[model samples]
Target: MALTIMIADDHPAVLYGLRRLLENAPRSRFVIADAVEGGQALLRSLRGRDCDLALVDWYMPPERGPSGRELLARLRTTFPQTTLVVMTASQQPAVLAASLAAGATGLYDKRECSSQLPRILYQAAQGRLCVSPSLEIVLERHYLTRYHWGQENHQALTPREREVMRLIAAGYTGRETAAQLKRSEKTISRQRRSALDKLGLNPDSVPTLAPG
Candidate 1:
């Protein structure tokens, strides 16, 4: 069955290009149910109609409505059944991580949308966490550079510590991470502190790395 998709962006050109790409692709598994400009329009369309998935730009005009993580979070809350894929031109690890934390099923770099978007969307449709290769590299480099952990130190992280660290690194708040892991906030804080100790990193210097 062809997956029904709703797309939203601030630019008409982007919406047109995306629609044309999906509509014209040979043996495409997707159908454009609706293509709208801006987050408010997207929300309005979703409220009136149901689709299998939503593809939205990360940055839209503020006047149009919430963008970035806030927009993704709202979509996730309001329409849990529809899969979400966020398209971004940002190369920041924090932004990428926050998108995932905000419930994006897939992350696609706008630069590679022409060639990679279909594959990314297909993976998300299949209930997989899909991230663009370029974006993955950016996130990896950010973690490696920021942590700078020795092999021994890296191996010292307990499974829970690793989980907490991963969520924290991904811009989740301590409360959110704790709730996600089904643990007490105190336990999450302890685990975070322990992980920081093992990595020999100063919590204050790392910003989000510090336990709340």
Candidate 2:
């Protein structure tokens, strides 16, 4: 039997192109689903659709506005057996590293969609890691930087603190952040203050925290 595959992307053009690519492949059976955002894709996959691979958009609007990392972490935990492949245009080292750390089996640069995808998908299906060469270079540099930065620097923030920082960076007001984090407004305020103080990130500084 051929492997089952699912593609989750927000852009209509990318979705159409991906469909054409998969449909033309000669070796595997693929199941494709279109979702405007990440949550819906997770919902459909969790319904026991039995996909062997999932090609997820690197960024998507969250269902309830949760961070993309949180959503990806949830999906990874819930669907441990499915091979998750990130298909995104983001070539930033930090972005690629985060996706791989979030349990993606492979990271395919969207620019490589024309010819590289089929081989990457096939490799991922066989339990091998796949990542764009550009991303690999970034990952290597990131690894070296971390080695120099020491584990202590990396351990500075708790997961919750990071989440709070991310939400704030996303432009969520205190009240909105409180609701999203499921905490009292006062608690959210405190968390934000603490994160800002630690990161030396000025509360007034504007940061575009891109999803995931």
Worst 10 residues of 2 by lDDT: 145-154
lDDT of 2 at 201: 41
- For each candidate in turn, give its C-alpha RMSD to the true structure in angstroms: 9.9, 10.0
Return the lDDT, model 2, position 75. 72
Relative to the unseen true structure, what is the C-alpha lDDT of residue 154 in candidate 1, on a scale of 0 to 100? 58
After TM-score superposition, what is the CA distance of residue 62 in candidate 1 from its true location, in Å?
Answer: 1.0
lDDT of 1 by residue, 1-212 (tens): 89999999999998999998988787898889899888888888899677889998998998998888789888999999999999999987667777777778889999874778888999998898888889877755545443332123657899999999889878888778878999988898889888877866556535473345
> What is the C-alpha local distance difference test score of candidate 2?
0.67
Q: Candidate 2: misplaced stretches above 4 Å?
A: 26-29, 33-37, 63-67, 145-153, 156-212
TM-scores of the candidates in the order shown: 0.69, 0.63
Candidate 1 similarity to native, TM-score:
0.69
Residue-level lDDT for 197 in candidate 2: 55
